[model samples]
Target: MKDIFTCDLRTNSKLPLGGKTIVFGGDFRQILPVIPNGSRQEIVNASLCSSYIWSNCKVLTLTKNMRLSVLASNIQETTTFAKWILDIEGKVGSLNDRETTIDIPDDILIVDSTDPIGLLIEFVYPSIVENAKNPIYFQERAILAPKNEVVQEINERLLKLFPGAQQEYLSSDSLSQADFVHDNIDETLYSPDILNGLRPSGMPIHKLVLKVGVPVMLLRNIDQKSGLCNGTRLRVIALGKRVRKAEIISGSNIGNRTFIPRMSLTPSDKRIPFIFQRRQFPLAVCFAMTINKSQGQSLSKVGLFFRQPVFTHGQLYVALSRVKSKDGLKILIFDKDGKLTNKTSNVVFKEVFGNL
Candidate 1:
């Protein structure tokens, strides 16, 4: 993938794998490689099939989806759903002259006039208090939001609804050591307010509000062998000044308790135009998570709160496909402009799939 990103297959003077045959496997429809601040053309150019070596590589595709095959009892519906998803991914839907936005099918849209968050909560996790401690219950359901701000809002609302002890942890936020080397840099430049505003995805916020028995996601891969990895969900059990204890709620290591300590985290956003690091706990409330983070994880039920439409390719597709059954998925579309609507945009760069 790196070779494709750099087009280095044809440009690298020193290359060990230049003579070896390699195999690449993944669904291009799932998620594309993330290139920080890279343009659409740059992203397409960074794909494996876009490299010069792709000319010599044989393209083989597997047509049958094992997931759909296993759910063969509802073959017709699933096949139609899968085709609709591919059309969105391929931008084959009826579009305006620019082909930017399309009218979402009414059958798939959930129209609501009141609070979307409240509606989504009741729809996905009815009787939440009864199953707050049951790890299996949380592992099967989650609300997917498109941005960190919206995820935080939904998590905060759900946290209030969760029945348990409330706990708050404030991060010791500061500029990185590298930023300290410059004597001209003032401490006031990176104040607590500014640091709080810099809550990028994959990094914890300045102040973390938690409650006992509430589910949270690990932000770092503390120990892969222990099933404590990024995106691993856990339920809070105890809290301390230095470490917080949580029971694993997902994966093969369910019910295992582990301690999370303060760790230094750096944001991967080159768009920030500044370099800084944060020292905070590697855990975030998991009542809701950004759609980007929910990729590759299957859920029994999904609540998609679209405060903002998806901005990139594969995001909408990934969010909608997280659930195993169509009946398990529920979407709430709400924007800042007081109106009940279900229409959204799908960004599909057709050229990216040209090699396929």
Candidate 2:
């Protein structure tokens, strides 16, 4: 910003930001900006509030969570759960020690489940096929998993439950056009199988199996105004060579049918030194979605499946708060060790919110 101001004064003899007013609003408790291969100081230095202009900024806060007031019934349970979520999120639990594990409320926990995914599907989507046509029905429920692999497993299992003929779509994976500029770039490095393996977690896989009436999520933001943004949920209506038709099942644009065309996708993984692109439909089965993807969505019924304990701050809180009412949530916490106890892990980096 200082450089930009200096450049403006040097060339145009005018300061664009000299008298301009700026306003910023956000919750510091939610996920912070993720900087890959960055140090703690580097990440903290990258935040907006860390700028020199922050001293001139005024902080105004909205205390109320509108989610609690919108619940239809079970106000008491919702209030209790909301506080519990806040307590865990703010590290105000009885065991508030930073290194100690937090105890989850017993009522919200599910145990003795050999088949957690199956139980979660049946619990969240009972009579899903019969009520598939109704967009509202799909909007009210979801399965939130901690990892992409778990989400994939749950989605594949749930896809089989949908009553329709399954259609498979394969992506055309090849070396990126940019790589052709390099004379020494090896073609074997861009093998389709290897490229598929290199795709990032949130991206659609090389092979996507879809059935009509099954719910799918947009992996990329195609049309935000039409409710076809990333994480937007839709039900498959028709499959085509170049475009697929689906009805928006969630958000303000519900019941609207939209055509999805095959688009070129590039994974934003820094681990892969070479750039690769895949041309395929930007949709993934949404029977289950990662907890990160479930952040902005509000479902009446939510199944929290934990194959592994949440390893970050506010993850447990985010998953539990997705539902409007406490009764709409059911959690299956795995006993990964032989402890056989329900425990919620909260990873709070006190330094992130320290200066705020």
Per-residue CA lDDT of model 1 for 25-52, tens digit only, reads: 8767765777766787787787876877
Model 1: CA > 4 A from native:
1-21, 68-73, 91-99, 271-274
- What C-alpha lDDT do the candidate models reach, one value each? 0.77, 0.76
Q: What's the CA error at residue 177 for candidate 1, in Å? A: 4.1
Residue 159 CA displacement from its true place in model 2, Å: 0.6
- For candidate 1, give the lDDT of residue 268: 85
Pairs of residues at least 3 apart in sequence or in different chains that clash in candidate 2: none
lDDT of 2 by residue, 237-273 (tens): 8888788999998889988999999989888878777
Give the poorly placed runs of model 2, Cα more than 4 Å off.
Answer: 1-23, 37-42, 91-100, 338-340
